[model samples]
Target chain A: MAATDKIFQHGTLGLLVPGLFDGTITAGELLTHGDTGIGTLDGLNGEVIIINGHAYQAREDGQVREIAADETLPFASVHFEKPDISAPIEATNQADFETQVVRDYRLRNVFAAIRIDGTFKTIKTRVAPRQQPPYKTLVQATATQPEFSGEHVQGTIVGYYAPQLFQGATVGGFHLHFLSQDHQLGGHLLGFEIEQAELKIQHFADFQVHLPIDNEAYLQEEFDNETIDHAINKAER
Target chain B: MAATDKIFQHGTLGLLVPGLFDGTITAGELLTHGDTGIGTLDGLNGEVIIINGHAYQAREDGQVREIAADETLPFASVHFEKPDISAPIEATNQADFETQVVRDYRLRNVFAAIRIDGTFKTIKTRVAPRQQPPYKTLVQATATQPEFSGEHVQGTIVGYYAPQLFQGATVGGFHLHFLSQDHQLGGHLLGFEIEQAELKIQHFADFQVHLPIDNEAYLQEEFDNETIDHAINKAER
Candidate 1:
């Protein structure tokens, strides 16, 4: 059986692996699971793009390059997507657009993997810088993140919408990452105003989590749930 | 690899499988994944008890029998557990008991698999009657369910406490089932008053959903989040 046929995830997002420098799962190995998703490179170098079975690294310097098969990542969410619905939408901001999308598509309570491709009036994004050992949590890592804003940025946003009940295991609400069509701009999506775009969602009827079962940090951490939740909210925000 | 080493589940509670009929996964196969959990029998015959790698059929007639390994069930949640913490507690009612458990253990905002064994002052439960084809939703099926109340019932309560974000994937809050020490009375747990009990919980850091991917009803159903949520709440209430 093909491994990538399911929603393959690696590491506990809640357990907080500080950086990707020691990421255990290889890009080549990960690709065996899904062809499209988002993550970061070794050392939390920048945003990661997995599309059409090719992995790309988009850096803070706006330099985009193809990641080698041997390269690894700290965390990622990917799926062998087969969209059940495709539709067009119009909206001005992130909030209104998401509300309209959900209302229009009637996707209130289901797990959905979505891809939106289009032009935007303004796109705001952020990429986490590289890190060293004695790492802090992701929220702390992103506290000093660099922001990018541009007009008429054409890109694709890829992510998922999980029911709020799955907040810890997955972000309960919409979580999206962006990559420019030219491959020069990309990061965790902060905000964007859609000019026109196509919204495609695959009914994600199943989910699975693979943890760093042998990782020392994951095993030792007490994982005070409130602290982790707050950290996740801040990072997502 | 041992299958019981991870949490294993089948079918979608969100899709509301009406009765335990034509269930494909066998008890032997399920035991290969987990040793303890709860579920219903064919045609919603009665409660199912699985513990220590053995399966028991607890029927409406208060008859308990060792389930053949080949017997199947509609829904169940179980894990190969290694509890992170175990302690004692006191509470007077279901709400108070749950509150005390969370407070005493300080379990918040995390997915937890819990087991409590001891004497209960009052144990209240309900079981769905056997259903036929053209089945209704679980909410409808339990509309006229039978309730059983017993004083000083000795049993073990088994279930999970999922964060609100996972409400669709699992019951967002505490979802539990009970099996008496005698194994003659059991079903989905509705309410209980703890006289004295030891609470054991595992930091269930992983989750996986295995749906009846080929079931026609599952494939065709469009779940309305609000309606399903309401139904679940009413049934649990």
Candidate 2:
């Protein structure tokens, strides 16, 4: 038998200590039955009292008191301490960028990711265009829902920003996008659905806006004559 | 063969889709030769096909693409959202009591069971004692240095409670206890070990704290005190 199996048998014999056996037993037999090898037995004066390396001695006091099973055992007890909760200084890091869009001096893009929570979703936003100042320019802007077709997914805008691209300039505009998921596009390839799906662009009329283009006055009036378009489309039955 | 064995054979057959065996005639013949009686011949029929009670129809133009040996399958992407932060309302039925040396009041004791992040282990907090007016009591506590030893655990006081016991005419000499688990003392018990633990109890030295005299108050207070004491003792070792 394997050493592990022999050890298990010996352990069982230890549990059944002080029990009577039917078979005749010698010192070697007893040691083998207990699964203790010959090397573990200690012989003294041929009396064969010691076995399995432990000395056997008779107690002077013969009488013993019986105890209930529910009585507590003589075991050790210890207290446990609470854990620490402060955030480590080096553990925090900057948020990762999801996506970016750039169109000449103007940029319209959306980015989305998860926080500490396990919710699956994303965020959408837009970046304003850079321009010269003192010219009263008309800017058109519109916000629309996002479109999802065949595994192509996007999100709605919770907020937006219209910062001036040029130094010392103030410009403002509107930004928006529809939010949904598409399954037909197959994978994460972009622009594939743009060619396959019927996309409608909603146009917004010119709106009054301001920006700074010169360093002398640090103020300038500009018109964003560009139309802000947003659209959402789904597959037809 | 047993039903479980038949199910296993069916599972293996399901892995061999139409495109998977298109170029392997030998392998297909070997699989078909097995008398499993749990397979369909037309894996890409235009009409709906049923196998093991599951119905699937192949699209006319949409054919299953053969997966490359080295190519990996695409997985779904997810974005998680942040949690909403809000305060919980305090419990009703608060009362006040007075004593010769110290004052006491009754406040609803709230205990919350919270699971630690990342680990499945659970740690329960002791019921907090909130005192009434004139005591200027607050239970602003935080957990720190939480350590577990055998069955007992210990934690440091990153925070403390001023006037740990409530003092007043309606609620005097009020104490709080935190229990880890409920068990009979005379039954089989587990030993606990602790490295370091401490609770900074700050009370007025001029007044002597008295245990509650009323049966209801006395029993509750006794239970709470004993639980806290036991936990502390276990943790302190």
Candidate 3:
């Protein structure tokens, strides 16, 4: 199979990049696999947004900057969005948007790669600050997460509809990350009010796994650490 | 990515072979992708077992036969298992076996492709019979599933550990299908008493989706039909 047809995941959510020191996978290398996805920089430095083949780092203080190809990521999940279906959605809140997608798009059982583009009358987001070791769980790392709320912003929501069974495997339901169309603001999506947006949907029927078994930090850590789930849901949700 | 590193899936569990008439994906074509996985024969004729590059059909009458390359499948998920970890396990029942695996093998939080070979003191299994058109949900079709129990049998348990989040996506967790060493008995695993067993494990770090969009039967079905989840759990679990 071609590299572009499958989802590329580095590191497991079971082992969140808490060992920020082990950010061995470079951003440039990740881009070769997919044109869009979401992830974090070394040290949980900030939330990441990759759209249209370029990477952006959204920091906790509500700052967004283009990341260089040399930048490395401890973990990330990305896939090229080749839409099989595209439609427009009108919703007042985040819940309304999801219901409309499920109802109108009929994307219930399959894995979906979605790109929603347009204006948001109100958008809420958060970015995790840099951390130090002994690294804490992802939830703990983001204990002091900074929230950014803005109005009249133009951005795109890049995310996937993970099947419910893969809840802890990936972000169970619709997991989305946002970036302003102008590339000025972005972070893990908390909520949004859509003024208007067009949705581009791609259905995925295959899966691939990219393990970090070779990394020293990955191998040495106890990935089955029980707290990882709580951390993952907190961070991703 | 090589074919060995990805899971090849045809059609969606939500769609099933409701239109059993649409089972156009040949076993030969599916085998070209991976060597180990499970599915049902066309028309949900029987449970399917593919291992070590060969296909076997376990029918409702307790008969097992090697399937022809040209045999078609409505849906299946398969991948070559390359063990990153292997070990021995001892347990009396299925539940005990799973707990021992999780505790000793530490296969939590990620997807696992596993093979368990050994002598079974007792084995309990079931096979879904062929369904007629104007088909019912998988659960209903499987309501009269035939049960088979055997003792002093030697076999291998072929299965995958799906993360909880992917609940409806693929059997949710630890889905195992058994094939007797004598090649005469096999079906979806229900319960078992293991005399002793050895395990070979592979961890997946990526995923790919292969949809059956070209099949006429697939195109005519409604995948979002809500009854699919109940049917899937009943038939799969």
Candidate 4:
């Protein structure tokens, strides 16, 4: 069936929004589900980017290093599938890229694994502060987050595109994370101007989300979905 | 992992809300995913309830019969697992049952396969009018749908419990369908007064939703999540 491509995701952005950052899903275990993905580490430590079976953590303090196999991830989306469609994309910034992808590729209602690799005229990224215990909601934690940018940069953007209905389950729209070719700069993609790039997208007809069923915080806590929606929009948007 | 239990679902409520009723996944294929389940037949002919490997359709015209293996399903949630927790439930009606289930079973944030079997002092059910080509939205189709009731009914309630965050992916809360033991009545549950009922619930950390990617109606059409949400609440509530 053409509907066979699947995306496996661990934990919802809903669980992460309310400061439930303690996680046990290891990077080693996550790779078993998908060779490429994007997420944040336990305690909402740093941004996680997985590509070609290798995982890396882009710290908020501006350090990109390989993630330990045992490193835990609170939330992530992964998939192992060859692209069904590959083409050149036209867009000036991240928002424009998402808008065009939604209009041109017609992906506003479904999940798509997106990868963009090439040179760029400019690139901008941001990362949340490494949080600790007694953690605050995502909106509070990212209140003073840092941003980084460069001109004439070359990098790859990796992430998943979820429909707006999945806002609390995951960040809606294109939640892309970037990494430079030199492995020196990267985090969540905030904006970019591509000089030249190739877009590879795989339609995920099957979306499998694994929740934190065993966690006491997840099972016992009273989650506020409406509030989380606002918090996610404020933090990610 | 207690998180290993999965609910395999075909299609989403979001797709159904947009009037994409034609389906291709056969009843036989659906049973292969789970021994017990709930859904609707293709073209929205009726409510489908599967238990103990047998699929039955509660038609809108009051005919309850075994569903053919070739029958197609537009949407369904099924799982192959024994209950993690089973207990006696106390509730005066369906709403009370749901409120107690959410509060006592701690199922507000998780996906669960729920079954309640026993006698009821009174029962109420509904079935949407069948549609052909040029279908209307689910809300419109079910606006004046028929409702049936019975006193001292012996039957089983079967369906899935989806968290509010999954509102579009599936109906939020308990979307149960009923089937009488004598095969005299059944359909989407509306209201009920239980004499006594046994509650069997399986925690499902894994929720896998399959979309009709090949359906032209699903692919090209633009969907409004806000409108769908309101429609679902009106129709289901």
lDDT per residue, candidate 2, A1-237, as tens digits? 212111101111110111101112233323322221111111100001121222121111211122122221110001111111111112111121112111211222111111111111332222111112222211211112122222223321111112111101111122222222221111111121221222111111111111111111211111111111111011000
Q: On a 0 to 1 DockQ scale, where is model 2?
A: 0.01
Could you say which candidate leads in DockQ? 4
- Model 2 gets an lDDT of 0.17
Segments in model 1 whose C-alpha atoms lie over 4 Å from true places: A1-5, A17-22, B1-6, B10-37, B40-46, B50-61, B65-75, B78-206, B210-237
lDDT per residue as tens, model 1, A1-237: 544335667654565533324576799988887888877776677788777677887677766789899998877778886777788867788999788867665455556778989998889888877777767667777788878777898888898776554556667678888888888688788999888888888766467766654555554455554565677787875
Q: Write the per-residue lDDT of candidate 2 for residues B1-237, one digit (tens) a residue.
A: 221111111111111111211122121332322211111122211211111222222122322122222221110000011111222212111121112112211111110111111111222222112122222101111012122221333221111111211111001122211222221010001121223222122211111111111222112221222233233333211
lDDT of each: 0.71, 0.17, 0.75, 0.86
Question: How many times do residue backbones clash in model 1?
Answer: 9
Q: What tens digits encode model 3's per-residue C-alpha lDDT throughout A61-127?
A: 7889998989888877888868888878767789988887766765555567889898999999988
For the candidates in turn, chain A alone yields TM-scores of 0.91, 0.14, 0.91, 0.96
Ranking by TM-score: 4, 3, 1, 2
Q: What's the DockQ of model 4?
A: 0.70
DockQ class, candidate 1? incorrect
- Residue A167 error, candidate 4, Å: 1.6
Q: How many Å off is the CA of A150 in candidate 1?
A: 2.9
Q: Find the number of clashing residue pairs for candidate 2.
A: 62
Give the best candidate by lDDT.
4
Taken in order, the candidates have interface RMSDs of 5.9, 34.3, 5.7, 1.4
In order, the B-chain TM-scores come to 0.89, 0.14, 0.91, 0.96
* Candidate 4 per-residue lDDT over residues B1-237, each given as its tens digit: 322379999988877887888875899988888889888888988888899889999999998999889989888878785898889888878888888888887898899999999999999999877899799888888888888889999999999899888887789888999999999999999889999989899988899988877776777767777877888888766
